[model samples]
Target: MSPYKGNRKINIPISIFVVVFAFILLVIPTSGNTEQLITLDKQKLPHKFSIAAPEIRPLVYIDKQGNIAGQFITMFEHFSEQTGIKVDIKVMPWGRAVQQAKSGNSDAIMPALYTNERAAFFAYPSEPLVIFSGSVVLQHRQDTRKIDSWHDIHDSQIVKVRSMNLGENVGRLFVNNRNELVEVVRIVDGLQMLQHKRVDYVVMDALIASSLIEELKLQDEIKVIVHPEESRLSNSYLAFSTSFAAQFDVEKIMALINQYNDPDKYIKQLEIYSH
Candidate 1:
């Protein structure tokens, strides 16, 4: 027997494939919602991710353009461009920002100071994303009782950003009056309160406070009360919600951060924006 040339077989009609494809198109949306969505695919799609942070001036803030702009935001934006993971930044009060992470409403929080209290709720990367010095406690220039040392703070009323841990330990020890160590929601609010003599001193980073003071035109009024003996060196890390940490690889994210984060340049950008 020779080779038999055969053409007769089950002819899968192209119309069937067309019908299946049309069904898929209806079942799945190509893009309808977010600006970052590459596709609305189910099995193969990249999911949207978000982060929250306190509006700490110069480091993380809502710029004059009403857009979230700062060091950490810039770093994540670069990461998003490289990795296709959309990073949404929510700038809120420090307390609410922490709450956002704890409740898993935000995927992560960044530039957060490490605390045993916070460690209980947020998962931090092994290394810090930012290390900064020059914490300052401000007093109005007119009220000018010198505060060059911890001894100088005396019985003065001071304001601390509530839900923030930096220098709070010392405040508890030094501030004899419980009511004297007032708490505020935002740093800008604290500075403004200090401006109006609502509080005698408002504690924050010297550089950050200066920028905000200039913006509010309170530069001439509020003066930094420096105490090198009580100088604070802070380390801030990218922290994720417990569930979100489990979802992503922490080391990979940290590597991306290290690649993109530049503190010196970030400061320059802040200066540019201030001008």
Candidate 2:
């Protein structure tokens, strides 16, 4: 034992110091690498985005508690949650809403039906948010004339909401004649005119017509006429203003919308709000 101890008494303190130095070397780089990884992950997230939507009912409207609420609103909220985008909806008249979006005062307008004129100012998504069918709403009476197509009702006194771009041909038909194609301020006004026999028919979205008829308790007074031969399906979409489209990733936004735009999901949202 004495002979072995002659090899310079091993420094216990030096051994402990060496072990600690090796541990520090290993842990220091690991800690630095972990911090760098966290920073890189944070950089991968997308920036927040905001949008503007009109005050249209069923699609977009103010709830009883004065909150922006509707089927589209629910969809937009879900979109925000998925993409980390912040959507701020402003409820205003459709005309003003369009103007705001066009002037870049707002980032976007939702539920916009496609038209060549609107395309100049906004970028539309390839997939539509909802597909709406147009119908001719008329008073329920025994002597009501049958309407098979737009040509059949062309000469009749037909009323529609003003400034509504139904389509190029339809818009021309309505605006070209002021008397035969009466432009009302509201859907209710058009319905009232039909009820009073002031107008032969009121051209409106079938979904809105049904909802309005039920809400107004005019089930017995008003009826929706379907024209199978006429193509009346309109696709509504979330359109971004030209300026906003230039700055943001429009394709990415559209991709998210198309991914989650489910009819069953909308139905569930409508049912929840109905209750």
- The most accurate candidate by TM-score is 1
Residue 100 of model 1, lDDT score: 90
- For 107-197, candidate 1 gives per-residue lDDT tens digits of 8887788889889988888767776564667778888475555555656677876645656545553545643677787787888788788
* Model 2 Cα lDDT, one tens digit per residue, 213-244: 77777776766555453235667777888887
Cα miss at 57, model 1 (Å)?
1.0
User: Which candidate achieves the best lDDT against the true structure?
Assistant: 1
Q: Which stretches of candidate 2 lie over 4 Å from their true place?
A: 1-50, 63-66, 140-156, 168-179, 196-198, 263-275
For candidate 1, give the lDDT of residue 61: 84
Q: TM-score for every candidate vs. truth?
A: 0.73, 0.67
Q: Going through the candidates in order, what is the number of backbone clashes in each?
A: 0, 0
Worst 10 residues of 2 by lDDT: 266-275
